[model samples]
Each structure stands twice: as structure tokens, then as C-alpha cells.
Target: MPQRLFIDVHIVQTVPPANVNRDDQGNPKEAIYGGVRRSRVSSQAWKRATREHFDTTVPEHNRATRTRRLTSELAKRIVHDTKLEREKADRLAGALLTRLNLSQGKKASDTAYLLFYGNAQLDTVAALIAGQAHDLAALDDEKLAEAVKDLPVADAFSTGHPVGVALFGRMVADIPKLNVDASVQVAHALSTHETQLEFDYFTAVDDKTEKEETGAGMIGTIAFNSATLYRYATVGFAQLTDNLGGDTEAALDALDRFVDSFARSAPTGYQNAFAHRTRPSLIAVVVRDDQPVNLVTAFEEPVPSEAGIQATSVRRLAHEYAEASRAWGDSPLHAAATHTFTTDEPRSKETAEALTAAFGDRISFDELRSGLRERLSAVLEAQG
Candidate 1:
């Protein structure tokens, strides 16, 4: 029953945050994240990147699966169920999306009708309102689910299956496609590869412009100081596989393409970043231009001061992946890979250096990656 599955890869950026303050309503009145001054990258920007990655990576076997528009479908379903006229339904759907704070996308992202819980719909506030109920949250699971069903919404949401990100070949056990069980796995992939958390910080500041200074942490109070954050995250295939699934050759291929494109296409305003380009192209052949993938790696340039054992392990992983790719027509199953993340910046070693510090010299670099992948895969399988 293993359906041919495809992977869903996403990335989020947390950088160039602005400092500021917020009011009682939770709308940020300020911003603060990084120690110094930063720029603002709306949540829309990050989501746009994610959509771009999906759009560019759909392949021949998965052409039917690539979708960037779910908003319209949602609207259609709502109109049919709510007994509203076409225009009214459409407008209502849009307003609901806004009110619910859903589909917060950037101009660059594609978010027309994407919804979660499979086709599983949430308890419509409209339903609650109609039934003369005060709060929708008070309803139990059955009532909540029943409240949303019998409307125009399709029953095909989730097959009573868990939702999770699929990695490598897709399908969990005999179940084709990563499902509810795969949530942790998907989370693993997302978490390991460029994750981010956003928040606002505000405070008072003294300035020549006749502004007064105050603590940046104050909320609902006026302050001159502010900061905003878009925390960034990135983990290797080992880490992703540890939680989601294996990092199959196909996934790696996509990752390879992602690294190349990302290096060239980071938002110009956010350009000047050498981090994504930490390594040189290791793929023997060039991927066709039509394909798109999201690959972020830490390419560590071999250094003389490095530990000899770890360095060899790094090289060994590359060798194994290269060999498997040719012999088996794919990357080795369950193999771990690593890249030396090198840079001139003060925090260049933060990624690689941090690992060595945490794991100590006992484990080889290759083993480190392998361990992560296997562990993640096992954990996801269990959860599913």
C-alpha cells in the first residue's frame, strides 16, 4: 500500500530583524531580536520562499501534486456549504481567512487555497454562531468535527491519517504517502532544515530627534527602542531523517539544486550572504534548469587546525554518497553526509564547531550524520 510518495521540503529565514515595542492587542509596537540594527522580512517573504521551493521542485512523477493555490477551493467549498451566493461566499471566505489569521503569505508566496487537517475542516465559527453558541472552543472533538462536516467541504481531507512531511521515497510502512504518523517526520525535515520563530520587541530610546529611551522589553507602553525577529534554522539530512524519513537520492538531488539556486537567488536585500554557498558543487552533472529544490548546507573548508579524525569522516561520507550514486543509480540508502561550513565571519564556526563541542571527538563525522538520519526515521515511524 506504499503509494509512490514525494517529499515536502520547506525553509524559513530569521534574519535582519527590527527592534520595536508592542501594545496590549499583541500587534507589535516595537521590535528587537539581533543585538544590532536589522531589517524587517515579513512572514510573507519566508512563506513565499517556501512556495517557490515547492513550485520549482515538482518532477515528472509528481507533476499532479505540485499545488500553490488552495484558497479558491476553500472559498468554493465555503460558498456551497454556507448557502451564501457566489460573491458573498467568496468575500466571506477571504474575510474569514483574514480574521482567522490564516494564509499569512508574502507577495512572493503562493497561498490561494492551502489548508491543513487534510480535507478535515475546523469547527466553523459560522456554525457556532448559527447554533447560538457563545464559543466554538467549548465543543468536543466529535461536535467540532460534525459542526464542520455536512457543509460543502469535501470529506477527503485526511483519511483519519496523521499528517507529516515525507522524506526520501515517501510512504510510511505499507501506507503510501506520509500521513498523520509522519507529522513528526515532516516536522523533523522542517526543523532540521532552516526553521524560524518570529516575535516583536519594543523599548524606549533616547535620540537627537527628541525621543526618550526606555527598556526594550516593555509591552503596551511607548518606547523608543524596538527589535523584531525571524529566527532561522537549518539542519542536515541526518537530522531530518532522524525525525522525518530517510534522505533518499532524489531528496539529495533536490537539495543539491536548492543549494545552487539559493546561493544565486537569496533576496537581493538579504544578499551578501555567503552562508548558503558554503560549499562548491559536488554533483557530477548539472541538473536541468527546470527543476527546483531547497538545499541548505554547511560547507566546512578543511582546515589545518581541525581534528584529523573528524576531517577524514567528512571526506568518507562524501565518498560513500558519490559511490552509491553511481553503483546503485542513487545515493546510498541510510547514508549520512556532511559539509565543512567555512567562513571569515566571527560566528562562521557556530554550526560545525557547536557539534564537535556537543558530541565530543568520540563519534566520527560520518557516524554523526548516520545516527541522526536513522534515529529520526525510527522516531517518525513510531509516531505514525
Candidate 2:
């Protein structure tokens, strides 16, 4: 059989009184599930939080920066590293980026779109201008433009990719060849139970105020909702490997960092007022050789409120998973691991370890990480 690779992650988390993701009107994002409203946190919000975790937790990992100030940033580097004056450096940097179709505005002071690039890529562009600054400066306007056109912009990314760029990928509007499709797909998190929106009327009193003042400083209403959220994301091992240029070790490392960060990170929205910094109550990691399966349909009817929502949701997940395996057979499932904090729910017949038992060896978080890598490496090698 051909080697197939994919990782599906499922998480059940509960957040207390907080607004993790808000919409345009300053209310928490929501969606209709099972004919009832449910609180929601956008995929972008959580992905950003996960990226921030990767930035702080992963050491020696080359990271990418997403910004609109590409020309300005490169100009500073040119001035600091080379003997060119600020004015000359700015012009040269703008010219090089303009040729690449990355700059806009009269002076090309900023990028037309947000550019996600690695430190190495930016450094290469700066070094190019520094090397030929004098020769390029002496040319007429037409000659300088023609000279830059001959530069090799495509070969700039010859070196290894930064971890962030490799994972999230990037798109160059005018240069489709430079576009990198994302290897990971994230689904917007939705609440398992029906939502009940609430508002908090807040006021801030000025520290230095007149003694006879009747009214306080600022007052406003903030919208929020609390519920158990079902979060899902999938990582394509084949695409990840290709993105890393077939480097197996780097792919494994990327997988490790991704899973860890996704499990621990939560968006920092309205955290100052409501510090809802909680971890997942239940987590399931599935490694499949076939296609990815999302058990979200189990909640399509929405779990009943009679039984505790979290406990009932946990039971429904296990029941649906068992049904899925029985219908599809174990050929698709390579391995599985699960972790749960809510163990003693009398309502739930399937505990974390019990649900994951038949799928694969029940193991700790660290063991699961290492074991998956080892198993995947063996599978990939045998296929070769």
C-alpha cells in the first residue's frame, strides 16, 4: 500500500465568563448549530495564538514576519550593514522590491499587500543592493529599472524555509510562482452547547476627579458568552514534508511544535477584564493512513443539557468515534492518543483511556509525541 499521512486533532475545552473572539459590533462571534445559536472563536484568532506560542516556545526555529513595511524595514538593514546613505538605500530597496511587484505608493514607501517573509529572504535582498549599489546608482532612471529587471529574484529562497513560512505558507499577488499553499487547515471553534449571550456593564472612575462630580469616567456594555468549545484542525504530513524539502527530521519537529502549541494556546481577547486562561478538558489525536474524519456531526443535534454538557459531550464523542471505526474498519487508523481532565463523570461510560484503547496504545503526552514520530518514520521508510 502507498504511504498515506495525515493528523487530525480534536479538542473539547471550557472557558469561563470571557470573550475570546469578537465580531464587528463588539459582540462575541456566534454560529447556528442544530437550529440553536452557539458561541464561536474564529480559526484566524486561534491560529494566531498558536503561532505566538510557536514563537515563544520553539528555540532556534527560524520564524517569518508578516508585515506591510517591507521596503522600510529592508532600507534600515541596508543603511546599517552597507556604506550607502539612508536616501540611497531607500531608493535602491524600493527599486528592487518594485521589480518583485512587492511595493506600491508614489515613493513605494510600503508594500501593496501584507508580505510574509523569512529573515534570510529579506537579508538576501538587502545584500543584493549593497553589493551593486554604486553601479546601480550611476544608471539613468530607465537603465536602473532595466538593471533590476535582470536580477534573479526567483532564486532568492534557495536556502531552507523558516518554520512559520513553511507551516502557514504565503502568497505573492502578482507572482503566483512565489506563492506557498498552507499545509495545515484549521476549523473555526464552535461551542458544543447552545449559547446564552450576556452583557457586562462596566465603568472606570477617574483617579483625579472633582469631589462633587456626579458621574464617573467611562461606561460601556461588553458582550460575552461562555460554553464548552469543540476545536478541530488537521496537519497534512505529506505537504509538511514537501514544504520542508523532504527533510524528515524537520517535518517531525514541526509536527511536535504544532500539536503542543495548538493544545495549550488560547486567544487573548478581553483577557484583561476576564482572564479565561484554561486548557483543554479533553484532547484526541488521530493519525490516519486514509482520509481525515471529523466527528463534529455527533454534536449536530446538540448534546442534551440534562446531563452535564461537558460530560455528555465527552460520551457522544466516544460513541460516535466507536461507530465510525466499526463502519470504516481499522485500516484507516494508524494510531490514536487521548487526554482528559474530567475523569470521574458518572454519566460518561467512555473515559479518555478507554476510548483511545482499541485505536492505539494509551500513552502520556510526551510518549505520544515521540511514539507517533517513530511510527511515522518507520512507515515512510518502508514505503520508500
* CA displacement after TM-score superposition, residue 346 of candidate 2 (Å): 5.9
Model number with the top lDDT:
2
> For residues 126-207, could you state the per-residue lDDT of candidate 1 as single tens digits?
3323332223334554564455444432223222211112221223232233223321121211111121235433454434
Off by over 4 Å in 1: 1-31, 34-36, 40-43, 58-153, 157-355, 359-371, 378-384
TM-score of each: 0.28, 0.90
Estimate, for each residue in 150-256, the C-alpha lDDT of model 2 and write its tens digit.
67655565346767777788887778767877878889998888888999998989998889986879999889888888898988888887778878789889988
User: RMSD, each candidate, Å?
Assistant: 15.6, 2.7
After aligning candidate 1 to the native by TM-score, how far in Å is the CA of 339 from where it should be? 5.7
Q: Candidate 2 clashing pairs?
A: none
Best by TM-score: 2
